[model samples]
Target: MAPILKISGLSKVYDSGFTALKSVDLEIDKGEIFALLGPNGAGKTTLISIICGLVSPSGGTVVADGHDVIRDYRAARAMIGLVPQELTTDSFETVWATVSFSRGLFGKPKNPAHIEKVLKALSLYDKRDSKVMTLSGGMKRRVLIAKALAHEPEILFLDEPTAGVDVELRRDMWNVVRELRDGGVTIILTTHYIEEAEEMADRVGIINKGELMLVEDKAELMRKLGRKQLRLTLHEPLGALPEALADHGLELGKDGTEIVYTYDSQGERTGITTLLSDLSQNGIRFKDLDTSQSTLEEIFVNLVRNQQ
Candidate 1:
């Protein structure tokens, strides 16, 4: 099957000689939750803007649901729902009216039943009659989502959807995103929250300095890059690792209370058993031991750093 969204050699260069995006290429499969991870000014939003037609690319082309975004702007845009980072809405407009108006803007026929369903799906049914200005920051963010869904777009773009929201609201938004994906909507979200990507995304894409660094299946990415650490609390303080144990590359902690051995999680021989035996032979004992694997955050940091 063809991809739901395709971007090829997408480049954006400002008149001032700054290139915001450089020969970026990506393919988002239908119904997949693709998360775009990047730090500030990394072109995450710029890329989204180009695909959504908010900004025109200096080079390359984008196809949304088989329609060229530039050549078929109307049809292509109609198939996309964008929840921008900023909460921009008509403050005085009641929730229901604003959402209904958005559908009309898309040239979609007024379907009150469909609007109701969208409102409820976003948990805005209770506040349907309330003005947007009266809602809290979190609720206002929900209003943005409601307006995006008003036209029933096939692809959703959520740019920092939970940036400043509280924990409960953030989780609630995550649930809504999952529900949308389960209903067959292709979701592409750009977020700073690594845990969010770890919890929700099917695939991960990392960008930095206006370039696409890497894109891979989330599980495979973790398996390929993840490292494990074996931490041992020493039974007694040691001045230094014995020469016999030096080959293990053990890093002694502060005050000689702990030692950490780093190794690849995918390795057939973690060297844990050998390290322990060697420690005994060298007369170094440990009080307790534990192991930990690298997190998505750690992986993301490493990717960005390596790209730089």
Candidate 2:
């Protein structure tokens, strides 16, 4: 199937001569949740802005669904719904009023039922009559999502949707996002929460310094770049590692009570068998041992750091 969105050689340069985005090329499939991860000023927002038609690109092309964002601005924009990082709703407007107002902005006919459904989906139905300023921070965030979905766009862009939300509310939003994707809305999310991407995204893209560093299936990326570590608790605290273990590149724990070995999971030979044998020969005894794989956050950090 053709991607729902396609970005080719997208570049953005500001009047201040700042290049916010490089030649970024990406394709997002329909009904999939794609997470774009990056540090601040990494062009994530700039990229999203260009695609949503809020910011024009200095160079490149963006096509949403079947419409060219540049040539068919209105149609392209109608296919997309953007939930910005900051709240911009009118404080005096009721929840229903603001959300319905958003739909009207796209020249969409009044659909009370659609607005109500969006409110309920975001758990804001009860607050529909409440003023925006009266709701708590979390509810305000929900209001933003409701407003974005009010127009029923085929593609949704959530830029740090859960930035200041608490853990429980954030997880709730994750579930809501999944339901949206299940209902056939292609989602493009940019988040500082790496775990959010790890928990929800089917594919992950890493951006750094205005360049898209890498994009891959989340599982495949983890398998390809993830490392595993073996930690053994010694039966007795060894004052020092045996000289015979020098080749293993082993690290002694702070108190010398633990032994650590880090190895690439993709390696043909992890050297575990040899390390164990060598340890036994050198009179090393372990009471217990455990292994752990690198987390998405760890891999993310390493990738960004290496690029720097």
Candidate 3:
């Protein structure tokens, strides 16, 4: 099946001679949740803006649901819903009016039932008659989402959708996103929270310094980049790690009652058995052992650092 969205050789250069995006190529499958991860100034927002027709790309092409974003702007844009980072809305307008206005701007006929459904989906049905200015920060954020959904686009772009919201609102938004995906809406989200992406995304894409770094299945990425740590709680304090264990890059705790061994899970050998045997021969005994696998956050940091 053809991708729901396709970006090829995409590049964005500004008048200041700064390149925000460089040769980014991506394909988002239908009904999949794809997370774009990167540090500040990594071109995440720039990429989204270009795709949503909010910003012009200096080079490359983007096709959304078989419609060219540049040539078929109306059809391409009509199929996309964007929730930007900044909260810009009609403060004086009631929620219902604002959302209804957004839908009409898209040349969509009024569907009061659809509007009510969207408001209820985002938990803003009660606030429909309230002015946007009177709503809380989280509520206002929901209003933005409501406005975006009012048009009922097939693809959704959420750029830092949960950035400044409280935990409760964040969780609520995730639930909504999951519901959208379950309903076969393609979602492309850029987030700073790795845990959110880890929990919600089917695939992950990492971009850095205006370049596309890596894109892979979330589980495959984790298995490929994640490492395991062997933490040993010593039965007795040690003055220092013996010379024999120095080559293993073992980390000694300040109190000398703990030792940590970091090893690649994909290697031919994890070296745990050898390390333990060597420790026993060297008169180092441990009372307890614990292991941990690297999380998506760790892998993401390592990738960005490697690029730098």
Specify the highest-TM-score model's number.
Answer: 2
lDDT for each residue of candidate 3 in 137-255, tens digit (9 for 90 to 100):
88998998889888999999999999899887799899999999999899999999889999999999999999999999999998888988889999999988999988788999849
Model 1 superposed RMSD (Cα)? 1.6
- lDDT of model 2 at residue 124? 95
Candidate 1 lDDT, 147-261, residue by residue in tens: 9999999999999999889999999999999999999999999998899999999999999999999999999898889888889999899888888888888899969989999
Worst 10 residues of 1 by lDDT: 264-273
Off by over 4 Å in 1: 268-270
Q: List RMSD in Å for every model shown.
A: 1.6, 1.6, 1.9
- Tens digit per residue, CA lDDT, model 2, 1-308: 99999999999999999999989999999999999999999999999999998898999999999899999999999999999999888999999999999999999999999998888899999999999999989899999999899899999999999989999999999999999999999999999999999999999999999999999999999888998889999998988888999998899995999999988865526599889999999999999999999899999999999998
Tell me the whole-model lDDT of each prediction, alpha carbons only. Answer: 0.94, 0.94, 0.93
State the TM-score for model 1.
Answer: 0.94
**What lDDT does candidate 3 reach at residue 86?**
90
The segments of candidate 2 whose C-alpha lies over 4 angstroms from its true place after superposition are 268-270
